[model samples]
Target: MPPRWPRTPDRNDPAFRRLEDFINFALHAAIYLAVNSGLWFFQLLNHPWDNLSIVSGVWLLGLVSHGCYVFILADYRRIEAAAQGNWQQELATELEEDATVTPDEAPSSPEQP
Candidate 1:
């Protein structure tokens, strides 16, 4: 199925796109906290300790974003490695197993008598 959301902006151009990404991260972080911490009931943005929203939002955003970016990179690396030769090694191992004889192998023939 197609993506439920619009395509993420390419990381190639980091000017306008990156700024938007930063803002989106901040909003998601805020909403995540609002939902999880029950702080939406309080005017979190107005309290003396309200800085938690900003701090937590940015912190969690950076942490989550960095982790997702790293995971994507790792997944890409794994795909590339498999494409290069890893799959060949796996296939060779499976074929080697097939080449082995096992006691469970079917009998070559049944006695006629």
Candidate 2:
């Protein structure tokens, strides 16, 4: 079966969250707009002749476009990749070194538990 939710960036990672807040914001905004879509149709009950649906319809279209960028084209890759640039491989190597380092020899950090 397919996943119910879209493939999203890790929220716990500050690099992915704040650096690419637009992706997360767009995703949630789309959901809110989608849920409210029916309200636009219901507006027909009061103003059958006015039909101002183009407002919501155009916003929904923009949401679909943003969704395509986030889920299909994978915009998160560009954000994270730009942060590491050429140091990705070097960072990986450093991570491997940290794995083998004993607690006593490990580097100190205020956040390390």
lDDT of every model, 2 decimals? 0.58, 0.61
lDDT string for model 2 (1-113, tens) is 85333456575443555446565766669676665566655775674534356666776687778667655665444445545574577567767988986668666667856
How many backbone clashes are present in model 2? 0
| Runs of candidate 2 exceeding 4 Å displacement | 1-35, 41-44, 85-113
TM-score for each candidate, following the candidate numbering:
0.27, 0.40
Window of ten residues with lowest summed lDDT in model 1:
71-80
Cα lDDT tens digits for candidate 1, 1-113: 84342555543333434445556766766777666476545555554555657866776777687546643432343344364567677668768989986669676897788
TM-score of 2: 0.40
